[model samples]
Target: MDQQNGVQIEDLLKLKFVSDPQLSPDGKRLVYVVKEINEDKKYQSNLYMMDVATKKVARWTSGKSMDINPRWSPDGSELLFLSNRTEKMQVWTISASGGEPEIVTDMDHGVSNPSWHPEGHSILYQFTNKKDEENGPIIVDQLRYKADGKPSLTSQSYEQVAQITLDTKEIKVLLEGDADYVYSSYTNDGSGIVYVKFEEDEPESYIQSKVYVYEFDQKPKAISEIKGTLSHPVCSPDGRYIAYVGHDQKYSHATYNELFVYDRESDSTQCLTGKLDIQIGDVMISDLHSIDMSPSLTWSNNSEQLYFLASEFGNTELYAIDLFGNVDKMVEGDRHIYQYAMDDDAKDVYLAISTPAHPGDLVRHDINSLMEEPLTYHNEKLLCNITLSIPEPVQYPSQDGTVIHGWMLKPNDFKAGEKYPMILYIHGGPHMMYGNTFFHEFQCLTAKGYAVLYLNPRGSHGYGQTFVNGCRGDYGGGDYHDLMSGVDHAIESFNWIDSEELYVTGGSYGGFMTNWIVGNTNRFKAAVTQRSICNWQSFYGVSDIGYFFTKGEIGVHMEEDPEKLWYHSPIRFVKHIETPLLIIHGEKDYRCPIEQAEQLYIALKQQKKPTRLVRFPDADHNLSRNGDPAMRMARLEQISGWFDHYRLIPKTSRVANI
Candidate 1:
């Protein structure tokens, strides 16, 4: 009943300082991007340079436009980065010491994710062609703004990789993507480049384009003969070898990325991690803010070791694994440490770390002494006054007997045996895992006296590939049971949960599950589904990967078998729903499209089900995470209110926020 128990949602969503940490070649200086969220909730991302030795910080690039992706030249004299300061993104360069940046690329399409060549004469970057502003002859009919109440578009082109000469600033097409291609890293010897391509077969299905090679003299070649998605390719310091992550297409949705290496001379490949049975889920795949779009999979100057971040023992930690296949843990617990970079000498590693209570910040870890040093500090004043709920890792058995891992955040001011309202929060990606990192929604729910439970159900990543892919064709079957069992286990295992006051909420696939949960059962008193897919048939034509992903995940396509699609859709079971539901959607969400929301809302309304559809204008599929801040706050507020309204709390006890 104290004032400290009631936390502001805005305060909970404060921008922390972290991400895009890059170490200079000599291990003396580090450059990173610090993101600032203003009063209007719009963001301004700027570049900051720090002297690792002196521990002094200075803002290198500052403006309204997004300034990020700082890459150090091989010799470490100059920095190459991508910026949108001129309205369109382009390659730019600045002195490592400090000075104005010079534009290095003049192209029609915006340039992004720039990687400096080892020799410093050229740079590699990704650029997507301008979208077809006018309606065009159909190649693909996209889901359009139907979710936001607009017609879908007929066609458009994707962004791809290109090589730009620093001397002339003339860009030569390296890989023109009919699909979206993300550049990872340049070879150590600068002979060619390695990049990940995303082939958009349907709006719902996304296949990581396999690794392709672009020799300096020859056209780009598809290096992947194995036929799956390849990403985060970084070469060893010797240039004789290359390391990358490969995901087999057969188990695309369910599998984790297996690390592999390619010998340049022998043209042969070897699996570094032996056939990984589990998917490498929760390994923050890319760092767009860094000059090198590929994450810091640093090739320890000796080329014998590779240092990268991976989730182990339920937390994302710094890990060093040798090319010969040995893994060692470096750090753990404080926060999710991602976007790391190491100097060639490999004595120290620079990273961006953030937690629920702390915004992100750039920090350095000395490999030899096992000491961590803080660099630039942001949001220190804001976080200093707040009391945060620490999340505890918990495991519960699923219906089919699989044990699922999850985290529970008890309210800040807790009392034993006082049953509290509960919220079962599900994460998206179906392949993504909800670990120990801090989350605003979880804190908000617990602050309001609701026990929060989030689990890595049947299909979540962080376990191996087989575990991640477990929910593929059995979406509503085992996955649903896993979720229900998690809920059941929470009531039985945790004395804090009130059995009579259960609620559910999720987004994307999680949202689809929310729709499914409400349709099949009414155990939860209320539900909120965000950017969800209600009917599989319509999703195929509407979402960006809809055509293929829909089929892959559900084992049915709109063309060959419409019945299978319908049966797998949540709308098919709408008639059996009894729970009050709130459907939240973004007006600009192309991934799930607004129609999915409209369909469910209309069907439920027709049945007189208590339902409300809240739409965010100009928001995309990631409304809660990367969408507009104001809109994100609004969404949390609305959903929390909906749950509070329907929650059956004890009348005799003193009601406290926490």
Candidate 2:
């Protein structure tokens, strides 16, 4: 084997990523999800068991499905998971010693977010059933609702919570078709189940979600009305409290999330974190490009301390607290840290960390020693001889005098006095921040001889709440200036960046800004917008949460302020575009629907601007993170191709003359 070819694409694809590590009930075998990429570059996830003593790993299932949410049976004899192997998403279980997997329930409708009963004999899951279908509902009349503050009408329907038992094979409908319920977890003694319910105005309304708890054989009761919103209800081990995230219904949707604890008896909740204003959302949350808070909540066995990961003062770290809401730091790193698990005895905690130079690796932290050790040796063999780009943190003042923070990755193998092409990358959520994390896309751009500049503009998280909400009601105003100034600073500060060969690309909010920038000015020679929002007027109606989120963030409701929505829309100025733009979208993306790409492509084509659209099949909004690996690489390659096609090539005649 001539190994100088570096690492094969297949090897990189086959590397397994471990997540959701849970210690067995007896605290012996640790179970976690081992995710690998298939030949198609699609991710295949399965539950695996690892013995702590020998570090021995054994496969628990061999099926053609992505199994996740692995919870060991209380006796540690069986493993429970949620999979799509049966054409519909449902719960399945297998013996921990390895055996044929058995389906637990056969609900015609799909089931998701499964939680095992504390006794491990029963399972609680959330399902979406069309309650109106039994009544034989018809679509003869359109359901009219406001979208992004514009009149939008569509079909109306809803979903609710459900439960099942493994031994009896009996099903119980504890909660049904009142609204949408998701992410249910059982109390320690399995006395009750806590879940989130969205009380919408109609099928298309955007209202904050409410937290509800259902006791065995009883009607569900709304236990807490969090100030902003609540999601992922994980109960503390003692059963006396539930730990969750709380956000302002208006500004919290896009910014950082706040962690809170609720007392079961008092019916009162307390914010656990006062130092940090935001909790890092999930690496993957929604089905589409929109971002939401999904704070990983775990509790110590004693139940006195609840643990979570949040970003405080611009750094993401692991934090813990007591039932009284007193917070303490657990683990701190320079980069983004998450996916933490406490041991059964609550003596040790394991975390997955990723820095600017490191992708991600498993690390174990001792609760008593306060020491951390590397648990897995991955990527070391692949990156031994490879020289990668290092992201240098940079900051500059925007037009409005906001001192914006950002990072610049210089081209690999660079030399002085030689100018190279550059790309300005914008992050998706207008509310999200591009922190000091290991980003594959940025690395690839630098490896191809292009300097990359990314910024935490006015609306990005990590900064204070005021800074994060700065872009509200002004999609392309100060936020646009912050981004433009970042590009300008990169060009001025780095002599290697060829100003004329600059390009720009972003998804969601970034995508919106890219389209807006190309329309307002021709600074970027080429551009690519992925899963972006083009027509704000149509976004509310087409997207899953657009109706409420748009009105809250932009201060416009479809029935109230049509003019304001139109003004902030990027599609309105597409006629003035001069840059060569590429549009990439996922077919199944419902947040920023494929129609957003269609509208931009058609508009750019109509204006005679060189434009192209690359669509991914069955992919959602987060095509980069959980999307097919090969497709993601292809996207990066295509982006490089677009910039290369428009790059300023040196004249051969000039070389001959010199």
Which numbered prediction scores highest in lDDT against the true structure?
A: 1
Poorly placed runs, candidate 1 (over 4 Å) = 1-6, 131-155, 177-181, 196-208, 219-221, 275-278, 281-295, 332-335, 648-658
**Each model's Cα RMSD:** 4.6, 4.7
Clashes of each: 33, 9
The estimated TM-scores of all candidates read: 0.89, 0.88
Model 2 steric clash pairs? 149-557, 149-558, 150-558, 228-247, 228-248, 228-249, 257-279, 288-621, 289-621
Per-residue lDDT tens digits of candidate 1, residues 55-156?
888889977667777888989999987788787788888998788889888767677778888898888887766565665555645432233222344245
lDDT of prediction 1: 0.73
- Kindly give the stretch of ten consecutive residues in candidate 2 with the minimal lDDT sum: 145-154
lDDT of candidate 1 at residue 112, scale 0 to 100: 75
lDDT accuracy of residue 385 in candidate 1: 64
Q: How many residue pairs clash in model 1?
A: 33
